[model samples]
Target: MYDFQKTQLEFIEHIKDPDNKPFKHPVESRRMDIYRDLFFNNIKGFLSSGFPVLESLYNEEQWNSLARQFFATHDCRSPYFTDISKEFVEYLSNEYELQAHDPIFMKELAHYEWMELAVSIRKQTQKWDASKTVSNVQMSQLASVVSYQFPVHQISQDYQPTEPSEAIYLVIHRDSDDKVDFTLITAMTAHLLLTIENNEQLSIDSLNTMMIESLPQLDAEQVIQGIKQIVEQMIAQEILVPYSISE
Candidate 1:
């Protein structure tokens, strides 16, 4: 019985790291190679899909080294395929380190790429009225309001930032067409979206009123007009979906 668990763990560890694996099972090396390739390829696919931009930034050899290290060292516990990307992010945070030539913002870039897929698959947690007017609104789960130290939205092969600059804010979401959209916004706009997101207990109208009251220095009518335009735009872009009770 003890040998059963020991062999199981040995097989798993060896499959994850075939090159320097300590355990030599009684099985033939050919069969073991098949097992190793199958499992590693499955994980590699998820890693690539979750961080496409990061993968593209590296040449094949560099990318393979990183992926191999993660596959061997990271103990992923998620049972869902979709959760693999989440595990990849956690692995990056805890277990992975950048090479000498790797970008300083590699982890942040990977995280930014993973977020789009995360938002795409997120289930809407609340029922919203599709027919309701945009004057009052609630943000959908599809939208993710995030702030970064660097402009992650503009990152590419050419636009790497060497130093942290001003705070960069963005709202990312999947539209009705199932296309992911990134909207660069001001800090103030990010706050407005966040307010709608966190204050689930209150309706949008009540929340807006509360927010405007808190900012007493601003003209009340002007603030309302600004918020109105933002909400309307979000609805038009399908970033925010409206809903109503069947009354």
Candidate 2:
């Protein structure tokens, strides 16, 4: 009598360990190897496509080694191919560490590279009118609006420069076309976006007031223009969609 749960666990354990006792027959052994190869290859392909810049940054040997390590260690939650990249990015952020003297921009660069594909595959069936919503709709912002405190744009994956420069703030968002777009934002702009996303109720004027106080160096007129420009850009990108209209 074959116990399904026990058999699956045993198979998993066997696949993970090279020195483990071999499974039953020639057929079983070959089948298990196929599964193991497919699993690793699938994950590697997904991650490589998602982080092309990172892939190019590292040599083939280094990239493959990192992929193998991630494959062995990360406990992926999704069986879907699309979700694998998300998990890989999370792993890179939480677990993977480059050299101590390695460019601080590396992490952000990996993330920036991943965003293009992430947004490209994102499901965005919900339709919202930009002009209408910005005028009268009540909306909730997304938590995924991340800003990295790194000058990632200046870093070239092809030409690894060796110097530390001032950090740049980045804003990554999925556009209306479902494409991911990245922009450099000021600290105040990043904060304003976070506040709106968190509170979901700050009027444009209120946001400007907060910006004025936060970025005193920027005059109110400049701040207003900047805010308008950002809002327009977000709308164009489809990051900001209409929520609900109030009577």
Candidate 3:
């Protein structure tokens, strides 16, 4: 007896690469071509939407060739359609073959694009009822404060750097308005956020003391006041959530 399940599996393998595999399906060739095109095109469309800039950088033929290779070789784990972008990144990071014409910052750029989507989708779990409901956590847990060697945020077709320069510091967070926003931060600001991450129970006074200790040559009072203002701005920007409202 002919096994339907085995035949279906064989049919799928052939569908992924119609030219290479012999089509064992008794179904007409025209109908099988539809299945092959439909399956691959949908995946390509999903990827194209996620990495629009990456797509733009390549010519149509080159893009289609890369898409075909990815479709044939990559085994995507994400069942959710929205997470296809994440899977694409995983593929690029692990298995993408670098071409001579491809930008050296391709991986960094892909990650930057993915980071924006990831931040937008991430939700805040802290419960706050106008100063009553208890929730305290580190900034690292609630936000993405990152530093990259490449100036990824500045990359475009018009401006592609061949070599690395100064570090790029960024804070990406979802605001009270439920929209994702990106801001450039100084190295000092990056240090402050990292310190808060390492010391989860940091208060304004403690942060000021640490700042003063680090920059001993500077006047303590001026440093403390400046640190306070920076922290206030961080709070206002929703980059850092304060444990105590008054603090």
Best by lDDT: 1
lDDT of 3 at 108: 76
Q: Give the alpha carbon lDDT tens digit for every residue of 1-247 in model 2.
A: 4687777766665554434544543456667779778776777887788877677777787777778777767888888778777778788889887765345567777776766666565565445653544642112222145555555555565566555555556666665444556667666656666766655545677767777887898788998888778776655555555443342
Predict model 2's lDDT versus the native: 0.64
Per-residue lDDT for 1-247 in model 1, tens only? 9999999988888888878876666798778778888988888898898888888788988888788888888877978889888888888888887678788788877788889989888776656666655435667778888888888878888788989879988888987667888899887788888887776544667856977987799998878888888888887876776665342
What's the lDDT for candidate 1?
0.80
Taking all chains together, the TM-score of candidate 3 against the true structure is: 0.82
User: What tens-digit string does per-residue lDDT give for candidate 3 at 1-247?
Assistant: 3687878767877877666777765788788779899998998898787788778788899888888888777888878888878988888899997898788888877887888888878767754324543233247334688777778888877778888778889887778777777789998888878887788666667777788888889899988778777766876777777564343
Off by over 4 Å in 2: 1-7, 17-32, 97-105, 124-144, 154-156, 162-164, 215-222, 236-247
Model 1: C-alpha RMSD to truth?
2.1
Order of models, best lDDT first: 1, 3, 2
**Candidate 3 residue pairs in clash (backbone atoms < 3 Å):** none
lDDT, each prediction: 0.80, 0.64, 0.77
Return the number of clashes found in candidate 1: 4
